[model samples]
Target: MDDATRIELEAATFRRLVAHLRERTDVQNIDLMNLAGFCRNCLSKWYRAAAEERGLGLDDATAREIIYGMPYAEWKDRYQREASAEQQAAFVEAIRKPDA
Candidate 1:
């Protein structure tokens, strides 16, 4: 594939992933951290970093709004749940690993 086509495909895939995550609000960030080692906040940070690479200024709030489809605080108020002890332990264990 051409470089342009590859970039387009990758962008499309990213959009799909973001859309999926937006729709799956029941899936908490800690769950994502435990299973995939990243979460929506990670995506927001990556998005902000990418904009910086292009000489664009994007703040955390804007990047998170783009990812969450709302202000981060609003999303947290509406959908985020308190992590269970099991989830917190898993997150701690996951981060303690060398590869994680």
Candidate 2:
């Protein structure tokens, strides 16, 4: 595929992933960090970084809203749960993985 097509496809895939995450609110961030090593917050940071790369001054709040479909605080209030001890431990272990 040409570079433009590849970029378009990747952007589409990213949009779908964001939509999926917005739909799956029951999936807690801690659980995602434990299982997949990243969550919506990570994705937002990535989006923000990408925008910055293009000389676009996107703030954290806007980036998070784009990912969460709401303000980050609102999403936390609505969908986030307190992580269980096991989830916390798993997250710690996952983040500590060598060369990850």
Candidate 3:
């Protein structure tokens, strides 16, 4: 594919992923981090980084809002749950894995 087409496709895929995540509020970030090595926050950071690379001045809050479909604080207040001990241990182990 051409550069523009590839960019468009990537943007579309990102939007779909954000929409899916917004719909699945039951899936906690800690659980995602444990299983996938990244979560919404990581996506937000990557979004910010990509903006910077493109000379766009996007802040973390704006990037997170894009990913979370609202202000991250609001999402946390409504949907975030405290990680269980098992989840915490799994997260730590996942992080410690060299492949992760």
Cα deviation of 26, candidate 1, in Å: 0.4
Greater lDDT among 2 and 3 belongs to 3
Better by lDDT, candidate 3 or 1 = 1
| Tens digit of per-residue lDDT, candidate 2, span 11-87 | 99999999999999999989887788789999999999999999999999999999999999999999888888898
Task: For residues 1-100, write the lDDT of model 3, one tens digit per residue.
Answer: 8999999999899889989999999999998898888899999999999999999999999999999999999999999999999999998888788971
Between which residue pairs do clashes occur in model 1? none
Error of 1 at 84 (Å): 0.3
State candidate 2's TM-score: 0.94
| Full candidate order by TM-score, most accurate first | 1, 2, 3
| lDDT, model 1 | 0.98
Clashes of each: 0, 0, 0
Best by TM-score: 1
Model 2, residue pairs in steric clash: none
Global lDDT scores for all candidate models? 0.98, 0.92, 0.94
